[model samples]
Target: MKHWTEDLDDDGDEPLVRPYTITGGRTTAGRDDLTLITLITAQSSSGTDTSAERHALQPEHRTVLRMCGRRPVAVAEIAAELDLPVSVTKILISDLIDAGRVSARPPLAFAQNGALPDMTLLEAVRDGLRQL
Candidate 1:
């Protein structure tokens, strides 16, 4: 399959291109050679094609996507790269997962530790977010 954002993102591959804040997605039918992105828009707008806030990816989320594009990065990795607490990253990654923009599966046992592994980000973050 072709990459959705490969050539379409004419802007250089810097995470700075995306705006921070705003969240939501748009769903489109399968196209031959296009990557689909979903975005959230403010409710009351003119019926025409005016722009909404959530259309742009946030810098943090954009960096996460860029990292994911390079390889399958766990949510913790995203948190670490952004230097955000794991709880915050999970909230963001959860949005991505819920929107079908990303997927989550159980983590694997480390080469050193053979314990049955669980989803690290979810486990590590859940305890803290429950307090907030």
Candidate 2:
């Protein structure tokens, strides 16, 4: 029996979902099964009915489910694997924690040791893009 959580990103900036199996919740033996999910919300936006977005399990969650299944993992490792900034990961993880979908420590320690590149990196990236 194992539980894992993953933060998956969509095409846009806003995060989509992290699939998980909560212990003692369902699927018996307190073991959560690896299951795929699809969501559909009947809400409309700007007078237009938007279809639900589809996202696969994020790499972090996929790794969690594959390895730990029910073990706890640090947010730092998760963000590292996903190659996302700690602040963004923190926000996503926060939502997951609030939703009871994932377990995480507070204060977002993962953000402490993180380093964000200055304009140099951005310029380099931009320069490279210009070359292409």
Identify the leading candidate in terms of lDDT. Answer: 1
lDDT, residue 22, candidate 1: 27
Candidate 1 local lDDT, 1-132, one digit each (tens):
878887676665455422233223222212221111222211232445324533554666566666776446665567668766555566566565555555554444433465655778768789879988
Worst 10 residues of 1 by lDDT: 33-42
Candidate 1: which pairs clash? 24-39, 24-40, 25-38, 25-39, 26-38, 26-39
In candidate 2, how many Å is residue 103 off?
A: 1.7
lDDT of model 2 at residue 71?
48
Which residues of candidate 2, in runs, are more than 4 Å off? 1-68, 106-132
Instruction: Candidate 2: give its CA RMSD in angstroms.
Output: 19.8
How well does each candidate superpose onto the true structure, as a TM-score? 0.42, 0.31
Clashing pairs in 2: 2-69, 3-69, 3-70, 6-61
Query: What TM-score number comes out for model 1?
Result: 0.42
